[model samples]
Target: MVIEKAKLFENTRERWPATVYVRPSKGVLCFVAEPSLVDVYEAVEGSCAPSGEWTAEDEWTHLANWSFHQALWALAERSAERQLHRNDVTFHMFDERMRFNLSDECWNAERIEYEESPSRFD
Candidate 1:
């Protein structure tokens, strides 16, 4: 089922942790905002799915991405009519655009449509 964007956000908010934000953008069906290293580690430790097979060690980054995408796939499979490839969703971590303080109120995920970029060139 082809879900509307509004419904998709509603479902994502209900299913994912408040720390995780998912939205749709051009060329991507879903985009998970930057995640915190701590959150990723915790997910890996708590995961019961096949992604749990990965240890939060040397390749923790890859495992974190895999685990997150796996969760995304399941969510889409349940609610979306279109098939989603692993590449359809993406996420990154530790970018300068975000601060790592998990307790920060600004970290809460929400749908925000910025009227304009701070930099015109961006």
Candidate 2:
């Protein structure tokens, strides 16, 4: 269970923010962002209703929820090098099973080599 935390930054070229995960000994593992619904639910269980259901009317509403947003912001703030505020950052998490390892790193680097390349999905 290698739980990795990442601080997200605005990606002007894309819709989602961006973050780079690294190992102290190794260089950058990969760049990632856009936490999936499963990742969000696991990170902040309280965001769900009593019945363990998401109640937001739309995806925007769900992402805008204060509790969810704050939780991720807090994570990012902790890992951030500089002093950042709520709107300044967002956060995401990944594990070894995801794309935070040497194998995935190769896929990301040499994507053209493989037809079915894996994603650095959060």
Candidate 3:
């Protein structure tokens, strides 16, 4: 899916000040940020609370939580790029998704695409 825009949740902004980029070809959204690994774990864990005791046999119970946690961790560590489909993201901690403010200079998808592409004139 083509990404029309993106926005960081107010809480996310305060936690991880990163630029968001959309990869239209891959149909994924990327967040480029430099947050401590500890912070990433804390933020993701806080957002997704797993019920009951976590064990190898009970791993299924925390699938969604773990999935997001891994993604967040990857983004923070920068060992590998983390990309998520628009449908996979819940936006805020609520059911309703937040609208991206296109006016924000930091989340410019066009500029990112332009920079990533090879210029024929070069």
Candidate 4:
């Protein structure tokens, strides 16, 4: 199943503490716990090219690309859409972009889990 769109949520108390909801073609929503931006940056920085040479910009680019892939994988695993792994998830630029605008949200907001269902959005 191809991902139609993704909704981003953030914990108000901490920076980069976020979650992403990936909606696939079958209409099932898969929730993924996203790591902090700092953590992703550090991990990408530690892995370098064969020559062991990298710049700050290169690390940032790698982090962005890797994070997107991780989100897709999370969606595939949680949605039980094993075909997504083989078919590849594609996104369109004009697709819907959703964001949860939480007011006075707490740290616990980061730990919330969404159950799978047919009428989840309805």
Q: Write the per-residue lDDT of candidate 3 for residues 1-122, one digit (tens) a residue.
A: 12222222223333333433322222243334334434554655555435645553232112323434444444333424544332333433211211122225764663354234442322
RMSD, one per candidate, in order: 15.9, 14.0, 17.1, 15.2
Top candidate, metric TM-score: 4
Better of 1 and 2 by lDDT: 1
**Model 2, runs deviating above 4 Å:** 1-26, 29-42, 57-61, 65-80, 87-122
- Total backbone clashes of candidate 3, pairs 3 or more residues apart or in separate chains: 0
Show pairs that collide, candidate 1.
Answer: 1-81
lDDT of each: 0.35, 0.32, 0.35, 0.33
Instruction: Give a tens-digit lDDT track for model 4, residues 2-119.
Output: 1112231111111222343333353352332234334544554455453677764443334334444454454545663223331133332111111121112441242122112122
Tell me the deviation in Å of residue 82 in model 3.
12
Better of 3 and 4 by TM-score: 4
- Superior candidate under TM-score, 1 versus 4: 4
| Model 4 CA lDDT for position 25 | 52
Residue 72 alpha-carbon offset, candidate 2, angstroms: 8.7
lDDT preference between candidates 2 and 4, better one: 4
lDDT of 3 at 93: 26
Considering summed lDDT, which 10 consecutive residues are worst modelled in model 2? 4-13
- Model 4 CA deviation exceeding 4 Å by range: 1-47, 85-88, 92-122
lDDT of 2 by residue, 12-113 (tens): 112223332312222342212244423544543443365655553222223323333444444543453333233433333222212222245544532232
